[model samples]
Target: MNLFMSFLLLFLLYTDKLAGLNFNTDVTVTWGQSHVAKSRNGEEMEFKMDQYSGASAQTNADFLFGRFDMRVKLNSPDSTGTITTFYLHSPNRDLWWDEADFEFIGGSSTADYKIHTNLITDGIGNREQQFRFPFDPASNYHTYSFFWTPQQIIWYVDGIPIRVYRKLSDSRILYPDKQPMKVYTSLWNSTAWTGEVNWKNAPFSAHYRNFYVNACVAWRDGSNVSSNCKIVPPFWFTYKLLPLERDMIIRMREQYMTYDYCNDKEKVTDVTSIECANNP
Candidate 1:
């Protein structure tokens, strides 16, 4: 890693500045008495939930304002599911689902986060938005992040920013505007909206480790934020951010650098970029 990135990685390893709050390492709770797979060393824990629930449950500690980051590796193949999510909710019981999150979705090793502007009353219409970013999450480890202020929310991956969504309202009551939010993390299988239920190829697993939070900056905009704030860096972000000379930079930049959006055929140029093009 480059000097800056190396230091940042080390800081992430040793400090909780990234997560914005303290985490209770010894505490882990689950719904329906989930199963846990323990590592031989007895240091790591994996929580598993079977069966599909239309809704998701949560295991949370307390926090109101700050950044949240976690290292996670998702489990086996799944065609339809909600994946895992990190969230915060309004302290008021009457306004549940008036929250924000770093939601991990299945079938693709990526993170999708959203903000709900209203209570969990009307479905999908309460001024909600989503951002999806790629992570070779299964083959290796990756970091997920969220930065929240009273008016804005930012999502990141490995210190790389993916989305910045803001609440644009003047009404204080409807806004989760200034409420201290409690942190929550949970896993659920949402086969209906996510896609077809393909258990034959599914029931995939996801793993999480080295979770941390740091509350450094107060809620504000126009800070010395990284350039990675708007764009989801290429898959080679970790590799490219390493210390290297100019030539190496060019070579790595060329081979791995691409703007191929699978859904946007207009951006895809080569035959190799075509999905199933070799087939009938």
Candidate 2:
């Protein structure tokens, strides 16, 4: 492994001693309790989806900024029309909510699987980017993670950065810095965006393990301020991409990216007002 990845692995190994939250104490099943299962040690969790219902779970604590990571093995093969999601979301569902998503849309075959990502600020979400995994995501567990700081939101697949969204000065492009969000994961049925479902492969399931978070926890009073974590400003709060990492991001985007909403002329009104306008 490279130096960066080695360091990340080391960090993950010591996560429990470095303030990692407990799964049973910090997380709770929010939907389809019957469909959510835990291991004998409570270190791994599973979410299942059937023709009847799907399962979801969320963290009890809210966070303002931090690095969130999850190792997931998507539903087994023939998982058409199923969607497995890991995301951070504000409590509100109206015009002023904030969210960041990592949604895996199941396909007919391993080659057809799509990793769809999106961000929403002030409830206006047109930022959608999709990529294809080189390996079969259902075959084994792969780490899907993201870093949310004051300046940028970066998506990563197996510790490799794939996409980034920066906070721009333009008022037209709002960022999610103002709201505290809770981490959530779910497995559900959806065919509107994904293709038709094959109920023949019923009872689709997703496995999750190694939930790690090193972030500024926020209070529960619905306030916009974060709690007084001793690390006032963690290294990640001001983290920037290194030259090598930037190069990797470019190469990955060119090779794996299938779609980017910023490139859609019909959907974006004034492209100049968005961050991608300058980056592209």
Candidate 3:
């Protein structure tokens, strides 16, 4: 095929395979309804926050295991301090709360996007992994996704695997496989960790497109199927891609990664995790 034909073919194939988008209409607007608006002709959820207020939204129901995705565009111009978040967790508070988080720490320019990922098992010490996206997220929309399963967890950006945390290979660590979790999204002031008010120009906004769930919902109720939903896990889980996925992760980390807990000098100890064995 010619170059043009090849490009077109790829585009068509990608779109044809595009996952279905679903908004958690049953979702709850945790706060600041006045600051939230539906735009993109209802295809996108625009969340805004100023010096006076912020906005948040969370799924009303819980899902046991699934691939959750959200296309997002961070606020441009000056996006410091304002934090935009997407996560999954159960209602259990304190030591029982199980959470997996994708947090945008904001940057001064559209070209500099700092993303922080974390997994909180049983409300324990923070296990944070951070990266900086080279592309200008504010210029357009990019899909961020979380794939949760009985064996492992994979984090993806634009369909490319960025990080993979396996189900605990070590007896010392805990995994979040037992409880179902609700999907959560929020936009609020994070100047404390981001920086002072002066460093994080306020009055920023967050844009979230339709969320896509790629698994049967019945898993939440302790069954293999759902009465109202029918679906299967995506192909990424079934194949072995250490060669390809590892290269993608290495390229991104070499150029864009900012911090990783696995590489922390103090944290890397007499014992090491095979997950950090320079493999994905």
The prediction achieving the highest lDDT against the true structure is 2
TM-score comparison, 2 vs 3, better candidate: 2
Order of models, best TM-score first = 2, 3, 1
- Count of clashing residue pairs in every prediction: 17, 0, 0
The digit string of per-residue lDDT tens for model 3 on 1-280 reads: 6644544454355345545544435567889999988753546788888878889988766776667878998887877777899998876666677899999887677656688998887886456788888677888889898877767677888876778777656766668876678888899887778864443455678899867775435434444324223355544335233445666777887877888877887766433455466334
Worst 10 residues of 3 by lDDT: 221-230
* Candidate 1 weakest lDDT stretch, 10 residues: 115-124
Q: Which stretches of candidate 3 lie over 4 Å from their true place?
A: 1-24, 39-42, 198-202, 218-242, 269-275
Worst 10 residues of 2 by lDDT: 13-22
Q: Indicate the TM-score of model 3.
A: 0.81
Highest TM-score model number: 2
- In model 2, the Cα lDDT at residue 115 comes to 94
Query: Please, what is the whole-model Cα lDDT of each candidate in the order they appear?
Result: 0.45, 0.83, 0.72
- Candidate 1 global TM-score: 0.55
Per residue, candidate 1 scores C-alpha lDDT tens digits across 154-260 of: 55557644444444432322334334455555666666656554566434454556656653222223432222222543222222222322333234324432321
**TM-score versus the correct structure, for each prediction:** 0.55, 0.90, 0.81
* lDDT computed for candidate 1: 0.45
